[model samples]
Target: MGKLGGEMKALAKHCGGSHKTVNDCIHIVQRFDHHLLALNVHIQRVAQIKVRHIESYIHERLAQGIGKRTLQNEMASLRAVLQQAGRKQVAEHEWLTNKSLGLAGASRSGTRQAITPEHYHHVLETARMKDPGLAAALELARLMGLRSQEAVQSVQWIWGMGTGVGGMWRRCMGKFDSWLRASSGWSRLPPFTVSERLGGGGKYQAALPSPLQSKPESDRTNVEINERTCPE
Candidate 1:
């Protein structure tokens, strides 16, 4: 590994997160290779990266048709590694601070688009027929309001916080999309079934955990008619 690659490894080691997260940060930093070279900022002197370099990079990326969210992730990764390497000042440059600039969909004067109930049911039913695992994952996300990462991963709903209060306690290793930042759309409430699946075959009584923040304002009006809706 060169200086930049070695610094990324150093960052991964110090960050001490899931392998995927660390690797993603490293990858994001690596994506700047061509631009960094053009700026004559080599891997060994990556810590010397400055705001101008970042601005130039942003312009280059934007010129090349990079999307807002992708750029956000790349900037985040760059900041993380630089900060981890004791170059916190460099990572917090004004140019890199604002999240809204050039970000598509960053302006939301209009209401967010919500998923329809009919569509939710159809999708769930179709997924169930096609793949039980996917259906179960969708159900977990819809009913419990678990993030995609939390749903697909192995989770242990251990009863510990309170005697009867049930909450998601543990999340094991798994990769799932979280950029959605909202529940998959359930515009109208879906049928509620108190099934054995919740209690783990009657081993533990399942108590509904706190509602997920992912629920959009439109979906919160009706409690009985639970609608699964994703706000995109």
Candidate 2:
């Protein structure tokens, strides 16, 4: 059978209540079927995927004018699917060795300009006038140095006495910055979930512990609360 047929069988066997995981896995795997079929490469039996095969897939995408980032994700997804099937050394394939596909580091360039204080307020004002949730996301992105992708999906507000919380963030969907900056202590924020944040799903630990501020404790005595502040 062709690769699509094989994937179809996989999807069929994987569907239904007990097979939710299999269905999800198939969904992720099927995204590549269109491209694979176009190249006449069969995806049946992951063992057939020589490293050179993956290289050709990448080269084909580049030749057809696909962006490096999209191609990178495509390869990553394929690698994951194969690995999930218990195939080891997925990346060990010699053709797949050019890990980054000669592309520049994602964060090295093209990230949007960080919002300066002035621009930050402007964007906030605009977002408030148009959409408060979106404005709040802008604020979080600015204060937290989070990518826009990480900002919008934050729904609840987690406050602390001193240094703020930290975690992987993206897919910013709404605006809400509503905590008072009153005391000084690293705070443990609550956790929430959403669609994969490009790069998310770590252990959800306080992995990067917040550093306590250097300001004198005596001077930071008063507690000031503001209801007007948005939650981000």
- The number of residue pairs in model 2 that clash at the backbone is 22
Prediction 1 TM-score vs. true: 0.50
Global Cα lDDT for candidate 2: 0.48
Against the true structure, whose TM-score is highest? 1
The alpha-carbon RMSD values of the candidates against the true structure, listed in the order shown, are 10.8, 13.6
Q: Which run of 10 residues does model 2 get worst, by summed lDDT?
A: 167-176
Q: lDDT score, residue 63, model 2?
A: 89
lDDT (CA) per prediction: 0.56, 0.48
lDDT of 1 by residue, 120-164 (tens): 889989997999778767776776565576567523332223221
lDDT of 2 by residue, 1-232 (tens): 4665465446444333323345444554564455566777756766655666666667767888877776665565566656655555865464574444654454435767644678767767888899866876665555444445545533322322223332112111122122222122111222223423334744122222222245565644333223323233
| Model 1 spans > 4 angstroms off | 12-26, 33-41, 50-52, 68-73, 92-112, 155-232
